[model samples]
Target chain A: MIDLMQFTFMQRALVAASLTGAVCALIGVFVVFRGMSFIGAGISHASFGGVALGFVLNINPLYTAIGFCVLVAWLIGWVTEIGRLREDAAVGIFFASTMAMGVLLVSLIKGYQIDLFGYIFGNVLAISRNDLIAMAVLALLVFLVIFFFYKEFLLLTFDAEMAAVTGLPVKWLNFLMLTLMAFTIVLSIKAVGIVLVSALLVIPAASAVQLTAHFKKAIIYAVFIGVVSCWSGLFLSAFLNIASGATIVLTATAVFFICTFLSPQRRKMRRRIGTLVKTQNS
Target chain B: MTTPVIDLQNVSVAYQDKIVLQDITLSVSPGAFLGILGPNGSGKTTLLRTMLGLTDPFDGTVRVFGKEPKKLKRLREKIGYVPQQSHIDLTFPIQVKDVVLLGRAYKMGLGKRPHNQDREAVEEALELVHMTDFADEQFGRLSGGQRQRVLIARALALQPDLLMLDEPTAALDVGAAESFYEWLHNTHKNLGLTLVLVTHDVGVVSRYVTAIACLNKRLVAHGLPENVLTEEGLQAMYGCDAVFFHHGKVPHLVVSTRDPEKT
Candidate 1:
C-alpha cells in the first residue's frame, strides 16, 4: 500500500515504462494483425548486433542500435520484394546469424561491461532523461507513420496483390511498415530486453483483441493495457526488489490470460443467473 | 471494337527450377467478360500474375494499354484485382472501409489523407456490392460470401476500367457463387468495365463471360462458349467425361474420370 507519488525515480520509472509499453503495444496491434510477428522478432534480435557494435565502437548504444535495426528492416523488405526466398526463412537466417555475430563481438571487446546484461534484461531503475526523450520521439514517429498510411498498410497486410492492382506500391509501403516496426522494436529493446521485446509488443494487443471488435478501439485498449502493465510491474518490482522488465512482461501475460478467460465474446453461451444455478444443480 | 486493354505476347514465367507459364499469348478486349479456365495446377494464376506485372515473364512481354504492364503507372490506375480467397488470412483485424480505402492508395498523393472523393468512391463501391451497411464491420467477422463482396468493393473502389477476379467464388455455396457471378455481370455491364475471371468452372461462368479461354498445360481453346466448350474441348480440358447439367440458366460441369487403379 505504498503511495506511488513519493519517490522521483519511481515516478520516472513509471512514466518511462508506461511510454515504452504503450508504444510497443500500439505497434504490436499491427504486428499481430499483419502476420509480421516473425519479422518483429527478427528485428529485436538484429538490434543486438547494433547494440554490440555501439559497445565496441564506444558510441551511444541506442543510436547505433536504432540505425542498425532500421537498416536490417529495410533489408528484410528488399528480400521480400525480390521474392527469391521465403520471407520467414530469410528473416530467421539473417537475424540468427547477426545475433551470433553480435554475441561474438560483445565477448571480443576488451573490458567486462556488466551493463550489457542490464540492457538485455533491462534496468528500469536506471532509465535516464535521454532514454525518456528517445522513447518520446520514437513513439511520436510511430503515431505519425500509422496515421499517414493507415489504409495502405491495412490493405497491404490483408491482400497485397489487390493493393498493388489499385496502384499502391504495395512493395514499398510494406517496406516502410517494416521499417517503422524496426524503430518501434528498437525503442522498446532498452526498456524490455531483446528476448522479451515481442512480449511487450504483442501481449497487450493480444489482450485487447479479446475485448474489442474495432481496430481503432483495439489499439486504444492495447495502449491502456500496456500503460497499466508497465506501471504495475514497476511498482511491484520496486516492492519486491525484483527485475522490472521480467516483472512487467509477467504482468502483461497475466492481464492477457485474465482478459481471455473473462472475455464475454468468447463464451459459448450467455450466463443467466438462474441458468447457472440450474446447470450446477443438474 | 476498341483496342484490347490487356495484351500478352508470347509471355513465359519460371520459378527457380520449374517454368510455371510458357509462351502465352492473349488479348482481353474492353468491356468483355473473359473467363480463364483450367485445373488446379494449370498455371491460370501464373498468367494473371504476369498480367499484373507482379511476376516477370521469362520471355516475351505483357502490355497494358500498349505500354509495359509493370512500367505503366497511369494504366495501372484502370485495373482492379481480387486474388484467390486462399491467399488472405481472414483473422487479420482490418475494417471493411479500411480495406476498401486501399483502392485509393494509388490515387492518393504522398502525405494526403483520403479526401471526399475517396470516401465517396468507397461508399459507392460498397453500395454497388450491397455492403454499405457493413462498412464499419471488422472484415474477419463476415461470412465467405460477404467477405467476397467486401473484397469486390475494395477492388471496385479503385474505379478501374478493368477488373480481374481469380477464383472469386472458391469455397462458396452454389447459391452464393451464382449470385456473385450475377453481381459481377451486372457491374461489368452497368459500369462498362472489362471483367476477367480465372476459374475451374467454365460451365458456370460461360453465360456471363462473352468468351472463354480453356487451358490445361496450354491454350486448348479461346473463343465463344459455344466454340471453346464443346465435347472435345471438355475432354481435352478435364481429361474425362464432363457432364453438363443445366438448372434453367446456369450450367454445372460435373467431371467423372475412369479409375486410375484400373488404368
Candidate 2:
C-alpha cells in the first residue's frame, strides 16, 4: 500500500476517493432524509447523456456533464412545482430519456467504446491532477452552501409546508438543493461511476441514520462512514485488482447492514416484545 | 374600528381548472379565536394556505395583516403556523430541540448560526408546550399526541402574533383531543395571540373557539359559534339536514340522512 502511494496516479485516486466520499455522503444525508433517493439515481444516470454530448462535441465531458446535470435538475424541479406531474414521475421520465440519449450518442462514436465504459464503471487509477482540482472545488462549493443554509435545509427536509409558511422561500431552496445534488453526483461519477454513484449518495446516509437520531449527528456519522468505506475499499481494490467503484459501494452496503443489525430502535422493539412474551407467560 | 388581521374579499381558489374555493369572503379581527369548520375536501386546508401566502387566489383579493398576502414578508415572521400532524414524517431522525430550533431559521438570517437568544426561545417554547423533558428525545419516538405537542412547540418558537393550526387534533384520541383543545384555549387566553384553527370537529369549534366559519366550497355561515353552529347553518354548510344537540354545554352537529323509501 505504501508502494502504491508512491505513484502519482494512486495518490490522485486516493484524493478523489476521499473527496467524493465526503461530499456525496453529505448531500446523501439530505437526499435520504427527504426520501429523494430516486432523484439522486436519476441525476447520476442523466449525466451519461452529458458525457456523451461532451464526446460528440469534442469538449471536456465533465464540463458538459455539469451543465447537463444542472439543466436536468432544474427541469425536474420545474415539473414537480407545476403540479401537473409528481416528483418521482418527472424523475423517471428524465432518467429514461437522458439515458436513451446517451446510448444513442455513444453508438454514434466510431471507436473507443472502452472510454465510455470507463465513465460507466469508473477508473479511479485514471484520475488526473485536473480532475482532483475540479473535485476539490466542487466539494468546497457544496460544503459552503450546506453550511450557510444548514438551518433552512433542515426545516425544508423536516416539513416543507411549515418552511413555506415561515417565509423560507421553500421553492427556491428546493431548486438550490437539487442543483447542489446534481453537482455532487457529477463530481462523484469519476470515483463511483454513474451506475454506482447513487449508492455512495444513499448507503452511507442510510447507515448513519440507523446509528443516530439527530440530523447533525447523522450527517457526521455518514461522512465518517463514507470516507472510511472509500479508503478501505480503495485499498482492497488496489490489492486485489478488483473494480474500485463496486467495491466501495459494497463496503458502504456492508456498513448499512451492520448498522441495521445493531440499531438501537430495533433492539428496543425486540426488548419490548420479549417483555410482552414474558409477561404473557407469567 | 380596527382593521381585520386577515381579510379575504370574494376570494376564489382553484387548482388548474377545478375550483376548490369559490367566492368566499371572511374577515378575522385581532385576538379572535376563529375556527374554520368544513368536511373533508371542502377547501379547509386551501383557505389556510391562502392566508399563509402559500397559495394565490384565482379571483378577488386576500390580505393578511392588513397587506396583500404576497407582500407579507416581514409580517410572515409574526405569524406562527402549525400544519396537520399527518404531514410530518415520523421516521425522520430529528430531536425535539432541533425541530423547535427550525422555527427560528428565518430570524437567524442567512449564514448566521443560532445564538443564545434563539436557544432561549427554543427552551421557552418547549416549556410552554410542557415538552422540556422531551427536548432531547427523538421526535419520531414520541406518540402521536406528544408529536403534535412538539410540533406546536416548534411553531411557538416563532413567537408570532397569530397562531394558525390546521386540524391539529385530527390524529389524537378523544381524551387527547380534549386536552389539546384545552391547552390551545389556555394558550390563546394567556398569550392574547390571534388564533385561526381549521378543523372538521364541530364539538371543538363550539367548545373552544369564539368565532366560527363554516365552509363547503363556499362560506356557508360566519359569526359566533352559537349563531353559525345551528341546524340551519349546518344544513347550509353540509348540504343535508343536521340535528343540533348540546352535551354538557358542548354543541354537536349530527348530520341526518333521510331514507329514500320513507321520503
| Model 2 per-residue lDDT tens digits across residues B130-201 | 999999999988988888898888889989899999899988998889889999999999999999999999
- Highest-scoring model, lDDT: 2
True contacts kept of each: 0.62, 0.80
Model 2 ranges with Cα > 4 A deviation:
A280-282, B248-250, B253-255, B260-263
Candidates in order, TM-scores: namely: 0.92, 0.96
Q: Specify the poorest-scoring 10-residue window by lDDT in model 1 chain A.
A: A265-274
Cα lDDT, model 1, residue A182? 82
Measured over all alpha carbons after superposition, the RMSD of each candidate to the real structure, in angstroms, is 2.9, 1.8
- Which ten-residue region of model 2 chain A has the weakest summed lDDT? A110-119
lDDT of 2 at B138: 91
Among incorrect, acceptable, medium and high, the docking class of model 2 is high
